[model samples]
Target: MSVEHDKALAAKGRHIALVIAATMLGWLAMSLFIGPALGLAGRYALLFDFAALAGFIYAAVNIFQLWRMRQDSQR
Candidate 1:
């Protein structure tokens, strides 16, 4: 049981890390290239910013959950 729980935690951690990395990189790419290439206005760029913000928030919540799970498991 403990082994399975640990594995699940590891998987969750990896997923959260991936989400954070992807959000940052994707936001950078869109802001730098896609937006300018498409000639998006400032308001339109905010859409991407908002999307990135959501992704980061999701990752943060998941990370907190994972931390709590780890703490409980340790105890």
Candidate 2:
């Protein structure tokens, strides 16, 4: 694979990782701190959890795609 292609893939992987990390941290903060501090409703907290799950799923799909690309390149 070309250097630029490799770099692009690496960048994408980094972006995906950052997104996953941020989503998890935000979810934790909301669940443990912000929600209670603000007296947010249980429904709102569940909504946030679902949003975080969606974000995680998105990251997982992208990571799988990137892995497939790398495998194809190896072939």
Candidate 3:
């Protein structure tokens, strides 16, 4: 790929990372405050935690993919 294309991809990756960070923060807020305020039970709260975990895993995968792409571009 051309340098310009690689740069575009890197920019996209940064945007995705920002989005993921925001989503994770939202999930954290929901799990910590919203759920309790809504009178959610432990099980329900646990579900929110699970959702956050999934988001974290997804974010990690996305970051890894971006890193790989950067490395490939360097070669």
Candidate 4:
């Protein structure tokens, strides 16, 4: 029972961390790239590149999370 609870807590914590990380990345991209490219005033400079970076970051995080979950479950 305790183990199950611990696992759930760990999973939730990881999920929240990932969510925050993604959100922060998105905001950074918007501020530094998307907004500028769109001429939206809130721009920085890395538009298309930012988009690519965002996608890659998301994919990497998912892969890492999947690996983590798999290892945790094996235990």
Candidate 2 lDDT by residue in tens digits, 1-75: 999989989998999999999999999999889999999989989989998999999999999999998999899
lDDT of 1 by residue, 1-75 (tens): 378997999899999989999999999999989999999998868999999999999999998999899889878
The TM-score, computed over Cα atoms with residue i paired to residue i, of candidate 3 is 0.78
In candidate 4, residue 41 scores what lDDT?
43
Off by over 4 Å in 4: 42-75
Minimum summed lDDT over a 10-residue window in model 4 is located at: 41-50
What is the per-residue lDDT of model 4 for residues 1-75, given as tens digits with 9 covering 90 to 100?
A: 368756975786677567657766776777776676788742344454466566667757776766686677768
Predicted structure 2: lDDT:
0.94
| lDDT for predicted candidate 1 compared with the true structure | 0.93
| Candidate 1: RMSD to truth | 1.1
lDDT of 3: 0.81
lDDT of 1 at 55: 100
TM-score of each prediction? 0.93, 0.94, 0.78, 0.51
Which numbered prediction scores highest in TM-score against the true structure? 2
lDDT (Cα, tens digit) per residue for candidate 3, span 1-75: 897877888787887778788878888788888888998888987787778788778878878778787788778
